[model samples]
Target: MQLDEATLRIVAILFSLLIGGLLLFSWNSNRVNRELLVLGSSFGSAAVGIVLIGIASLGQSVIYLYTGVTLLFFAYGGGWQTMRIFERRPVKPWLAGLGGIFWLALSLIDPEHGPLITALAVAVVPASYTALMGFELWRGRGEYLPSRFALCMVVGLDSVLLVMRGVFIMIAASEAHRWTETQLTMTLSLLIVLVNVAVGYLMLSLIKERLETEQRAQTLIDPLTGLGNRRALHLHAERILRRQATSGQSVCVAIIDLDHFKKINDTFGHFMGDSVLRTFAERATLKLRPVDYLFRVGGEEFLCILQAAEERDAVGVMERIRRSMKSYRIGEGTEARGVTLSAGIASSRRVGYDLEDLTRAADAALYKAKRDGRNRVCVYTGDDTRLAADVEGRAWAEPRPQAGPLSGPQLT
Candidate 1:
C-alpha cells in the first residue's frame, strides 16, 4: 500500500491486531502468565481505537470519535497495567480510566485543540508508569537476560519520545502533528511497528528465561526441606574453600544428623517426619549467618559450610542450632513431641581447605555425637587420641568437643 499517514495508520492497526492475536496464542499455550492477557488487551484495544479514529475522520459523529480515542487511552492504560502485573504489583485500572475521563472532558470543552489537549493530558500516566517499570527492570540487570532489559529501555525511550514530542509542539507555537508531515508523527508510526515486534520477542524471552531458571534451581534444591541438595552443597563448598584460602580465613564444615530420624518416620508416619524435617531446616537456617551455607545433603542429614576464623566459632554455631531445635515440636496439643539434632563440626584450620577432607572429618565427629547418646555437638580436634581411645569402636571420631565441651541433652 501507499506510505501516507492513512496507510501508515492502517499498517499500525494491522501490526497491533497481528501481535495481539499472536500474543494471545502464546498466552493460551501457557495461561499462567496473567501479564500476557493484559498485554494482549492493550494491542487489541490499540487496533480498535485506531479503526474508530480513522472512521471518525471520514464521518461527522463526534460520539464515535470520542469513544474510539477514549479506547486509545485505555490501550495506554493496559500497557501500564501489564507492567504492574509483570512486576507482581497491584493493578489500578481506574487511574488510567481517570486519564481517559480527563481527555474526554478536554475534548468536549474545545474540539479544535481537543486532540492536542487529550494527548498531553493522558500521556504522562502511561509514560511515567512505563519509565518507572523500565527503571525497575534495569535494577534487575543481574538476571543476565539482556532482552528483558532491552525491552524496558524500549518502553522508557518510547515514553521519552512522546513526552518530548508534546513539549516540542507546545514550544513551536504550531498545531500538533496528527495531520501534518512532522518528525513526531513519522517517529511514532515507526515506533509502533518496532515496539510490537520487540514486545512479542522480549515477553517470550522473559517467560522462557524464568522457566529455565526455576528448572535449574529445582535440580539443586531439596523438595522436602527446600534446602540445597548434595550437588549444590559440593558446589558451594568449593566456592567457600576458594574464598577461605584467598582471605586466609578458615571455614568449618558441619554435618548435622537428626537423631533417630528413621524411628520418628516409623512411629509418626512419613508425613509427620516430613514436617519435622522442614521445621529443622527452617530453624537451622535462621540460626546460621548469611555467609554460612546449609544444604540437605542426605536424608535426615544437613551439611553446613560456615565462614569462621577458628574452630570454636563452628562449635558455637552448632550449639546455637542445637538449642534452637530443642523447642521445635511437631503435632499439636497433648501429643506434641520435641525433636533434637546432633552436629559434628570439622574446621578448615585443622582439615585444610579440601571439601572432601572437611566432610570426612565432619562425618567422623558426627558419628561420635551419635555414639555419645545422640543430640550433642561434637567437633574434630587435631588430636586423634579420642578416636584411637574408642577401642570398642563406638564412634568414628573424638568423644570431646574440639572448641569447648557442650553439656548436651544427656546432661539436661
Candidate 2:
C-alpha cells in the first residue's frame, strides 16, 4: 500500500498528538499510579503507530517489518497491563505474542503475504484488547462512575476503528474492488490509521476531563469531613435558588453547631477535637435525603439545604440529623467516648429570597439553643418568637448502649 505524502503527514501529526496528550496526562500523579502505567502503555502504542506511518511513507521493507514487530510488542504489553488494571488474568497478550511471532515469520517468507498476517494481527489484537477493556469496565462499572463510562466509550470507539482497519487492510492486499476509484486502497488504509489516531487522541481527552472533574470535586469537598465546604455551600445554594425561582420548589436551609466545641478541643486536644467535628458532620450526612445538601460552613458550623415536600418535612429531616449527630462519638485517647450535638433549623418556601436570610434565621435559632443551655435542638420560625424551649431539647437525650465502641468519623 502506498500512502500519499500529504496523507502520511496527517497521520504522523495525529499520532504525535496522541503520544503528547497521553504523556501529559501521565504526568498528573494524583490518580492511582497504575493508571499512569496504562497511559504510558498507550503512549507506547502511539509511538509504534508513528513508526508504522514512517515506514509506510518511505516504503521501506525492513522498516515495515520492524514496525510490525514493535507494534506487536506494544499491543501485547499494553493489553496485558490493561487486563491487570481491571483485575483480569491477562489472556490476549499470549495470543498476541504468538500472532506477533507468526507475522514476523510470514514477513520474512513473503512481504506481500505478510501484510495479510500483520494486518490481521494489528486488527485482532486491538479488537480483543478493546473487548476485554469493555468487560473490565462493565465489571467495575459504577466503581468510579464517569471515569469508567469515559473509558468504555473511548475503548468502544477504538475497537470499531480497529475492526474497520483490519477489513481495509485485508481488502487492500488481496482485492481492490471495495473502495471507490478515487479512494486508493493505500489511501483507505491510511484513512483507517488516521481514524485510530483520532480515537487515541479522544481517549486522552476523556482521561484529561476525568482528572479535571476530580480536581474540581476535591476543591468543593472538605477532606476531613467529606462534606461540602463553604465554597460548595455557596455555589449549591445559588443553584438551588435559581431552580426554585424557576419552578417554585420549596428549599429549606438549616444551621448546625456543636455545643461547647472549644471544650472538646481544650479537653481532648485538637486532634480528637477535629475527629469529633468530622464525625458530627459524617453522621449528619447519613441522615440526609439524597436531595438534601450538607456543608461545613465554618469551624464546627454546618449548613444543610433540604428539598422538602413541605416546611414540616424539612423540620423532620433536620430532627433526624440532630438525633443521629447526638448519637455519634469521638474516641477518648485509648478508650472510645460518646459525644452529643445541637442544631438549629430554618427554611424558606418563597422564591427570590437570599440564602443569607435563611442563615440569619437559623443562626438566631442556634444562638437561642445555646442560650437555653448546651445540647439542645432549636428551629427558627420566621417570627419574633425564639424557637428554643426546654422540653423540645433532645441533645444528650440518647445514651450510648455500649460504653466502649469504635467511634469518631468511622473511617469515612
Candidate 3:
C-alpha cells in the first residue's frame, strides 16, 4: 500500500528526530567525540526543516518554504562537516553554511522560478554533501576502521538517489512544482529515513572501533618515552620468534641499560631523569634499523630485537646507539651532562628462538659488560667457560668505527 505525502513526511521527521536523539545521547557519554554531536545536530535540523516544510505544504506560505529549504541545506552541509571532523580535519563553518546561503540568496533574487530552483537545490546540494562525505571516508580507509567502507557505500547510494530524484523533477517540472506534494518527494523522504538510521549506527560503530583500538594500544605503550612497553615486547617477540623459527633466520636480543641513570636522577631530579629517558629512546630509535623492535622493559632499561641479525650485526647497532648517547649533552653549557648506555646482545644462533632464553643470555652479557666497563656492547658467548675467553679474544667485542647516520627507514 502506498503512503500519502503527509504521512511519509511525518514518518521521515520522526525517524530523523529519533536518530538525532540517539546520537546526542552517545555524545553525552563521550563528549570528546564532537563529530557525534555535530551529526546529531544535523539530523535535528533536518527534522525541524521537514516539519516546517510540512506546515508550509498545507498553508502555501513561500516564506516558510524558503526557510525550510535553507535549513535542509544547512543540515546536509553539517553531515559533510561531520566526516571532515571525524577525519581530524579542521571544520569550516562558512563552507558548511554555503549551501544554505546560496539557497536563500537564489530564493530572494529569483522569486519567479523559486519552485524550480528549490527542487534543484534539494537535489544537488544534498547529493554534493553526501558525495563529499563518501570521499572523506574513502580517504581515511587506511585507518583500519571496520564500518568505514560500508558507510561510504551507503552515502554513495544516497547521493545517487538524490541526483536521480533531481533529474526526474527537472524532466517533469510542471508536475514537480508542488515540490513537497510530489510522488518522487514522498519516495525520497522514506529513503532518507532509512539512510539516517543506517548512517547514524555506522558512524557510531566507526568511533567505537577507533577508540577501542587506541585503548588497547595505550595498554602496551610507554607514554613517557613513546616506546613499546614490556607488554608490547612480549607480544611482538612471540610473532618475531615464530617467524624466525620457520625461516631459520637469526634473531638477536639486546638488553640495554642507561649508565649512571641513578646518578642523573639523584643529581638533577626525576624530571631530568625523564628527559634523559625520552632523549635516549629517540636517539636509539634513530640509530636502529626499521626491522628492529625497541621496548622499554624497566626504569632506565630497554630491549631491542634485531631480526635476521647475527652477533656482529647486533653489536654494530648497539655500538652506534652507545656512541650516539655518549655524544648527546643534556641541559645547557655549564649544567650540561653527558650520558652513556651499555647493551648486551644474544643471538638465536646461540640462545635458540625462545624469547626467555634469549633475554636471559642477553641479560648475562649485559652484566658482564657492566663488570668489564660501562659504555660498551658485549656479545653472549655460550656459558661462563667460553665467556671469559670470548671477552679476551675481543673477536666481535672490539668497537667498530662510528658509522654515518643509519640509511634505511627508521621505526615509527
Q: Name the candidate that leads on lDDT.
A: 3
Q: Where does candidate 1 clash, by residue pair?
A: none
CA lDDT, every prediction?
Answer: 0.72, 0.61, 0.83
True-vs-predicted CA distance for residue 307, candidate 2, Å: 1.2
The global Cα lDDT (0 to 1) of model 3 is: 0.83
Q: Give the candidate order by descending lDDT.
A: 3, 1, 2
Query: RMSD for each model, in Å, please?
Result: 7.2, 7.4, 4.2
Candidate 1 lDDT over residue span 1-412, tens digit each: 2356577778888888888887788889989888788878788987898888788878658787788878877777777777667766788888656656777887798877765665565346446655655765666665666577778867777677656655554443345435343466556656746765676668777867877877887888788887788978766667768989999998888899988889888878999889888888777776666567778888888998888546666666677778778888766788777789888878887889999998999888888888888878887876641331322322232233322121111100
**lDDT tens per residue, model 2, 270-319:** 99888887677656665666566778888888887776434556556666
| lDDT of model 2, residue 92 | 50
In candidate 2, stretches whose alpha carbon ends up further than 4 angstroms from where it belongs are 1-70, 73-123, 127-165, 168-183, 329-337, 349-352, 386-412
Superposed on all Cα atoms, model 1 deviates from the true structure by an RMSD in Å of 7.2
Tell me the lDDT of model 3 at 250. 92
Top model number, TM-score: 3
TM-score of each: 0.85, 0.67, 0.89
Better of 1 and 3 by lDDT: 3
